[model samples]
Target: MLPRLIDEHWRRIGFTQRPKLAAIKHLCREVDLLHPQVDDNGRRPDNVEYPWTGASGSAEVPAHWKFPLMSRLHDPSGKLLLKAAVGLTRNPAMFIR
Candidate 1:
C-alpha cells in the first residue's frame, strides 16, 4: 500500500526517473517484505498480520516478535520514509495531479 502510494506520488510529480534515493528504495523494499504474497505452493509464511509456524515448530505471531523489517524502523531508510510521509500528509496538494 505504501509503496503504491509513494510510486503514485512520484509519478504525479513527474519524479519517476532512475537513480531514486538509495535510502528510499531500501525502505520501499522493506515495506514490501512486510506483506508477503502467497505463491502457487502457498508457502510464503512471513506476514505482519498473522501467526505462522516458525522453523522451531512454534507458532509465531508477528505482533509478538520484532521482524527484521520492523527493526529497520530505526534505520536511515525508515527515517527517510517517515519524513516523506509527514511531508505528504502536511501538504498533499503538492503531489496531487
Candidate 2:
C-alpha cells in the first residue's frame, strides 16, 4: 500500500537536484506509523477506489467517493517536532512526567 502510493506520488512530483526515487524512499521512512490502521478498532481498508477525474476534484464529495491516500501521517499525539528533531507541542498535557 505504502510503496505504490509513493511510486505514484513520485511521478506527480519532482525534486530539483536529487532523484525522485531516493526522495520518495526518504519520505516514506519519515512518515509516522501512528495509525497502522485508520480505525480505532484496528481495521484496515480492504477496498480502495482512486479518483476518476484528475486535478478537478481533490476532496471526496459524497459517501460514495473517498480520497484513499490524500493525507500524510502526522503524530497522533500532535507532538510535531522541530527542524532539529526536538519535539514541539501541538497538544499539551498529553505526556507523563
Candidate 3:
C-alpha cells in the first residue's frame, strides 16, 4: 500500500527533483510489511489491520501492537522524511518542475 503510494508520489514529483532521503524507501517497506497479503496457501497472515492468531494460539490485534516505525520517526532519517513532507505540503509548486 504505502510502497505504491510512495512510488506514485515520487512519480508526480519527478525522479530528478525528488528528495534523496533514503528513509522514505525504508518506511514504505516497513509499512508494506505491516499489512502483508495472505497468500493462497494461507501463509503470512500477520497484518496490522486485522486480528490474527499467533503461533502460540493467542489472538493478536495489530492495533494493540507497538510498531518500530513509531520510534524511528524520532531518528534522523525519519526526521528528514517528515521535513520533506511538510515542505511539500507548504510549497507544493516548488517540486512540480
Candidate 4:
C-alpha cells in the first residue's frame, strides 16, 4: 500500500526527491500497521462526510474520505516529525518537548 502510494506520488510530481521519499518512507513505517486496513470500512456515526468537490463527478469517491491525507496525518504525537519535514508547522519544538 505504502509503496504504491509513494509510486503514485512520484509519478504525480514527476520526481521522487530524496527528502520527500524519505518522509514518505518514514510515514509508511510510522503509520500504524492497521491504518490502511481501516480504510475499508471504518466510518463512524460521528465521522463527518463532506461532499467530494472534484471537477469531474465521475471520479470515484473513496468510502472513507474525510480529510486530505496531510490533514489526516497532522498531530502532535502521531507523526510530528513528518509534519515538520513537510513544513506543515514552523515550530515542532513545542511538540517535541
Number of the top TM-score candidate: 1
Clashes of each: 0, 0, 0, 0
Off by over 4 Å in 4: 12-19, 33-72, 75-97
lDDT of 1 by residue, 1-97 (tens): 4445566676776765722356567666666666756422455476787788887989989878676666776776576577667877898765466
Q: Best by lDDT, which number?
A: 1
User: What clash count does candidate 4 reach?
Assistant: 0
TM-scores for every predicted model:
0.60, 0.19, 0.56, 0.24
In the order shown, the candidates' Cα RMSDs to the true structure are: 4.7, 16.2, 5.5, 14.0
Ranking by lDDT: 1, 3, 4, 2
Worst 10 residues of 4 by lDDT: 43-52
Model 2: how far is 3 from its true place, Å? 4.0
* Candidate 4 Cα deviation (angstroms), residue 24: 1.6
Record all residue pairs in model 4 with backbone atoms less than 3 Å apart, i.e. clashing: none
Model 2 residue 41 distance off true place after TM-score fit, in angstroms = 28
Model 2: per-residue lDDT, tens digit, 34-56? Answer: 23333324332222332223244
Return the clash pairs for model 3, or none. Answer: none
